[model samples]
Target: MRVEGLKLTPVSSAGIEQNASEVASGSKNFGEFLTEALGEVNQLQNDSAKASFDLAAGKLQDVSQVTIAAEKANIAIQLTMQVRNKMIDAYQEVMRMQV
Candidate 1:
């Protein structure tokens, strides 16, 4: 399985620092951040779907790889749902507040 498109790279400190700077600088709004995060989750799901389909079609050799991809997509979706729930709770609490 020569996965040409799936190359894993080490997470460098510079990348983390840049992301932090962008958030701290307000270059990206909350909605923009949320949208990007959701887009990534969507991509994960799509990749997982492709892996699953390939597995069923016998195009994929390793079942473990498909399993891992599905799990990764599941976790991403779960995290996104949790974040959304928290945001909804915060909004409702703010609405209830007598300000």
Candidate 2:
């Protein structure tokens, strides 16, 4: 079963490096980038919740869309958690350094 308008693309390391460089070069700060990422995750979660509600209410016909939205939200949340963990680890390591 193929879902229309659903396209999966591989992420490139070069693109990630470019984005990091842009953020580091004063175009955008780390805090703003983090905020935007969190906002996107929140939006994906909201979309998944709405899709679930629609499906439960018999208003949605495509189950694949709902599944996709849920998976997107889940992956975003997992990635956010990983990043948060890494940041905490780095902070603790810095604190362990001698002055």
lDDT of 2 at 33: 82
lDDT of 2 at 60: 98
- Computed on alpha carbons, the lDDT of every model, listed in order, comes to 0.95, 0.95
lDDT of 2 by residue, 13-98 (tens): 99889987886789987898899999999999999999999999999999999999999999999999999999999999999999
In candidate 2 the C-alpha lDDT for residue 18 amounts to 91
Q: Kindly give the stretch of ten consecutive residues in candidate 1 with the minimal lDDT sum.
A: 1-10
lDDT per residue, candidate 1, 1-99, as tens digits? 775787798877998899999989999998997899999999999999999999999999999999999999999999999998999999999999996
Candidate 2 residue spans exceeding 4 A from truth: 1-21
Task: Using TM-score, give the best candidate's number.
Answer: 1
In model 2, the clashing pairs are none
Please give the lDDT score for candidate 2.
Answer: 0.95
C-alpha lDDT of residue 73 in model 1: 100
TM-score of each: 0.82, 0.76
